[model samples]
Each structure stands twice: as C-alpha cells, then as structure tokens.
Target: MRLVHPLSVVRDAQDWTYQDVVDIVAKATKRSADRRKAWKWENWGVEPDAESQAALAAALGVPLGEVHRLGWPGWLPDGGPVRTSFPWTMAGTLDALDDTLEHAMPDRRGFMKLGGQTLTLLAGQWLSQTPDALAAAFAGGPVDEQLVEDLESGLPRLRRLEAALGGHRARLLLDTELATVTDLLKQASYTEKVGRRLLRLNAELARLAGFASFDAELHAAAQRYWTTGLRVAHAADDRALGANILKSLSLQCYDHGLATAALALATAAVEGAGDVTPRTRAMLLLRQARAQAACGNRVGCDRSLSEAETQIARSTTTDDDPAWTEYFDPAEFHAQTATCYADLHRPRLAEVHFTTALDLMSPAKVRDLATYTIQSARTHTALGNADHAVHLLERAAQLAASAPSHRNTTRVLTARAELPMTKKDPKVQRLDELLATLSA
Candidate 1:
C-alpha cells in the first residue's frame, strides 16, 4: 500500500470544499437519506464504530487515520477509543495548505488577483494583531522573525489594495487616512494608545509606496510618515523611538545632499531626546556630525564628532538600547568622520579615520567597502601620493564594478578626472585606461 504524508493528503483534498467533501462521501457510500444523515453526523450524534469508520475511509479515499485525527464525534468506527495513529486533523491539514499557498505566492500583485477574498481576510487578521506584532518585532528577540513573516504575508494584499485603487486613488486614500490619524492625535485620551500607533505604521506604509508614483511625490508622504511616527512615539513616551524616527528623516535629507536640513533634524533629535540614554544621544550626535561634514562645516563637524565620542564613553552599558541605534559603534563613527574629512580636503585626518573605519567594518557591509576605498584614493591624491592614489582608485573601481550604484560611479569618475594632473605617472595612465574601459 502507498503511504502518503498526512500533510500531502490534506493538500490534495483542499480543492474539495467542506460541503463538497461531504457530498463526495455521501455519493460513494450510496446510503439512504436517513442512513446518510446518520453516517455524516451533521448534528450532534453518537460516534461511528470501527466498521462505519472503515466504510467512511473507503468512500472518502482517505486514510482512516485522517478521519480519526479530527477527534470529532463519529470520527472513529463505532465511536471507539481516540485514534493515536492519526497525526493531524482535517482542519489542521487545511490550515497547512493555506499557509503553503500564502508562502508560495509572495509577489503582491499576483496573489491579490488569485486570492482576493482570502487576502482581504488575512489583512484584517494582521491589522487586528498589529499592536502586539509591532511591540514584539521591534523589541529584539524571536519576534523579528514573526514580524518579518507577517509583513511578507501582508505584502501581497497591500499590493492588491494599491493596484485596485491606482495611483491617484491610493494617494487620496493615504491622505484621508493621514487626516483621520491626525485628528485622533488631537484627542489627548487616545494619543498614547494602540489607535495612534497603528496610524503611525499606516503612514509609514503609505510613504514606502509613494515613490511608485510618476511624479515621485514621495517626499510629502515620507514626511507624513516621519511626523506621524514621531507623534506616536511621543504618545507612547518612548524618547528613543522618537529620536530614531527623526534620525531616519535626517538620513533621507542627507541622501538628497540637503546638508543644512539634515543637520537641523539631527540636532533637533539630539536636543528633543531629553535625558535620553547616553548611547542614543551619541547616535544623534554622530548623525549631526555627518551632516555638518557634508556641508563643509569643518569645525562644527569635528565638534559634533568629539561630543559623540564623549557620550559613548560615558555609557556604562548599551544592552538595553533601541534597535535602530545599535548600528552606531566606534568604527562606524570613525568611517563617517573620515568621509567628512576627505570632503573637507584634510587627507591626513581622513586617512586616520578611514583606516580605523576599515578595520572595524565587517565583510557583510560590502557596499561600504567601495566608499572607503574611494575615500582612501582621494586622500592619497590630496597628499600628493599619485602612485598610491592610482593603486587605490583601481581597487575602488573594481569594487564599484561588482556593485553598480550611480552615486558611487560618479565618485569613481571624479577620482579618475583627478588622475591626469598627477606628475609623470604611468600608474595614473594605467588608472585612466581602466576607467575608460568602465565608461565604455
């Protein structure tokens, strides 16, 4: 006899609905109306005996173990002792199939179309559990795994919702949601509760999809998310969370080269995170320093960096810190500081920081490698070491090739431009040739 896994049997039976399964069993048995009713046990009735159990299994073409698994009345032949052989229930089997379907269909657009009703129902389920999920996911533990899984599960539904609404309609819906959330914030009693927190998360999701618009109207959406998230954090009386949200906004500004705005946001975060933990304060200050350096404010940047170091030193324990701020460490700070110095044309200072930063970096942060290598080349060029600069730039170019980023490509191109002016350099010529190949 062929043995099938209980799970596989359940999956194969999924195409037959509950009612369909009952109908199939009824027809196969060819019982009279009263006998069919007795065998199916639609209402509460006595359990089936061993002979009846065998008959039902033969009709259903499923293992008797499968029927006995549910532990329902009439599940066993003659309502005998509970069957230990059955490993899973029909419901459990169906649920496994449901989970399998959800996992197999990760792409948002496809699933929404294929399972619209199921997607909607699951979305509601996720929303109902949002508060608990958020707390656990952000709390640092096995919760992150579940949180990611939930997000993955909900993504298809969200995509479907977006597709149904289209661009303009979706923006309108987001705007309306944001307005409702803002109004909720006005009521002091609800400010610190689950309602406000959910709204904050909703705003963040809207911002993530905003860039998909044609005109790229994501800036307003991003600001809405940050602002709402800050208010929610404040309501929760979580200073670190508020600071982290502000830090995200500052990084966005920095990405756009809005140095002044980035600096302002980072400084505000440092100040507003009042009496916040020393580690959090250091992180905010580090961001401030990075922004200042980007703006060519050498003195201001150095001052912020020093302050950050001092704060880090003052911390006795960093174990209970926020998840977002955990990425800041001595090496990361030094690397960022090196980039600042390089931008300011202080090659010696840049070299010191870059070396320290490089030493601290892990192999996983491969993208950072290109940035650090490029900085090293620029520093060498500034120091009048053309040979070393050429060698470093070549390495930087090779790294850049492996990972294509427009911003890093621009940096490499600029570095190549500087090579021609170096005095009587074969290395410079060779570097130029390599860069030429890249352009082609």
Candidate 2:
C-alpha cells in the first residue's frame, strides 16, 4: 500500500486543494505550475523540480533547505488535519466549541477548504446522532435570567445591523457576543430551563457568526462557526437549528461548486429537521432544490422546489417559529428559486424570479440586495439584453459601492468579468471602470 501520500496529507492538514496550492505557489514565489504536473506530485509521489519545490516551500512558509533534507512529503509541513467527527454528546459539543474558539483563526489564505469526503461524513453523522442524549448540568455562580433574556432580545438588533451594514462590520461583534454567551454557560449556574435557553442562544450566535464570516469571505472561519454551532444546537436538542446550520454549509459548498457535498448536506438538513414550521421546511427544501439543480437532477429539483413553495405558502406570521426564520419572506423565497433556475441555465425564468424578489425585498438588506442585483444582472446578460444588462449592472454597481460586504463586492467583480470588454457603449465601459475601482 502506497500509504496516503505525505504531500496529500500536508495539503489536507493545511485545508487547501491542488488549485489553492498552485495559485499560492505562483503568488508566493512567482512560479507558475501546470495543474497536471502538480497533481502528479501528490498522486504519483513525483519529486517536483527545484523551482516547484521552492515555490511549495514558500507557499507553506517552510525553509527551502527542508526540501533537500527531508525530500518530497517528508519536507512538507505537517499543519494537522481539521477535525469534524465529534461525538454526539454534551461534553463533545462543549469541546468542539472550545477547540474552534481557541484555534480556528480566520483563513488568512482567503480560500475555500477541501471537504470532498469530509462533508459527506459530517452530514451522515448529523443524520444518525441521537437527539439530546444527555442532560447538561453546571455548578457555578447563579446565572441572571434577565441577563440571558437581554442577550436574547438583542439578537434581532444584531441581525438588523448585519443586514444594513456588511458582515465584515458585524462578524467581530458577533464573535465577541458568542464568547460572552459561552463564558456565561461555563461560569454561571442556571435552571434546566435557563440552561436550555442559553444553549440555544449559543447555537444561534455561533450560526450567526458563521453567516457573518461567510459574507466577509472568510471560508475557514465560517466553517468553524457553522460546525461548532451544529454541535451546540444538537446539544440543545434543537433539531431545526441544527438543520439550519447544515443548510448554511450546503449553500457555502454549493457556492464553491462542491456539488456532491452540497447535495449531501442539503439532504441531511431536511431529513434531520423534524417538526419544524412550514417556512423553515421551505427554506431547507429550497436549498436542497438548488443542490439538485446543480447535480442535474431536474426531477428532484422540481419536486423539491414545488414542495418548498407549498410549505412556504402554508407559512403564516402567526406560526410559532424561530424569529430568525421570519426572513424567509417572499423575497428570500423567490431569490432562492431564481438561484436554482440560474444554475439550470434557464436564465429567463431566473430573471423573472429575480425581478419579483427585488420588487419585494426591503432596502434595509443592503448586502443581500446588492448581491442579488449583481446576480440578476448576470441573467440579463445571459438573455442577451445587453442594453438592459448594462443598466442593471450600473444599478448593481451603485448598490455594491454602498455596501462593505466582501461577498457583495465579489459579486460585482464577477459580474464585471462576465461583461463584454469590447463593447464600446459608454454605459458598459463606465460600469466596468466603476467596478474595477472597487477592489482597489
């Protein structure tokens, strides 16, 4: 058995893929590597050329001499692997949360991590884990109920601020708040009722922190928050919240073209969520539909979308659902529907849904509004409405400029790339110029 290549092991430990290594090598050492050549180094244990080894060394922040001393995999830095298979117990949940808080710093590499098989394994664990297998008991100072309630009450306000400003502005604040909640859980004694509520709050804060990290384009940070949040939610016996975190991870994976993992996560989300409100089901199903669409499962996608629509229609303002889920209004529903159609290459249908969503969306959701606007412009471009597309791009550009979200700004950048550079129209040229300045 050619034991798992050390090169491959090192890449996994660093939470990167072949492309990430290639790009980083070029950036770090100004040396370009053919993808096929790099793949052989990992898959076939081929010794890289001196320059390639030097580039890899620089990318991994290791001494170049190590390449000669240890050779190949031996010279590669061992950063350790990212852990995902935590036991489904309260103690395990606490440990996961604590580990992430202490060590999972933001991915300074600013790239998505490789999770090909790990994502599937994670969802499988979530699906099979027992719900609230053990009760939590804490012996500490008395926890003030009012303080817990105050923190809970402030959640909506934090969300509002996140929607109005960008995630970068809100992420640190969310992390700080989560740390406060975690400290209370560890040090302050509370009744069973209070403890449960605090645990749920911890879960929600972690989930919100993940969402903020994603919006800020910190992929590894988002994963840390999301996985920890899922464990916390499971500990609280909040199946719906746990499912919601899975859906968020699914969306992130889908955004990065990890279709298999995205689909697995989505399936786990719906299957694991028991006895949720109609809108909550709708949100999860919509995510599942997108993954299905990405996988070319038109039948499954259509079925899931239809079911999502039915569930959403049944949802009412009076439903006893989590307050955070109220955002699954007509706007969010249609936007997700549009995403599925966009992935399926049905631009006309996507444009129609995007139009409806924009019509219903509140201006307060600046980051979302800006992102969807850019996406809607892409559909317009696909439909060959160049003139109208330019108009929409201009509108999206203004929206993007107003928001500080790295995600929203990235959408604008992507849209700029999709445009026809040769188009001499002043509006098109102007849109490009305005977008080019954003990253600067």
- Which candidate should be chosen as best, given lDDT against the real structure? 2
- Per-residue CA lDDT of model 2 for 194-246, tens digit only, reads 78788899999998888887887777678888888988888788889999999
Cα RMSDs of all predictions?
A: 23.7, 6.6
Residue runs of model 2 more than 4 Å from their true location after superposition: 1-51, 54-80, 132-136, 421-424
Q: What is the lDDT of residue 221 in candidate 1?
A: 35
Alpha carbon lDDT of residue 410, candidate 2? 72
Per TM-score, the best of the predicted structures is 2
Model 1 stretches astray by more than 4 angstroms = 1-239, 248-258, 294-299, 316-318, 420-440
State in Å the error of residue 91, model 1.
Answer: 39
lDDT for each residue of candidate 1 in 10-61, tens digit (9 for 90 to 100): 3234543335534544565654324444424532344544554466567646
Q: Which lDDT value does model 2 have at 23?
A: 78
Q: lDDT of model 2 at residue 238?
A: 88
TM-score of 1: 0.49
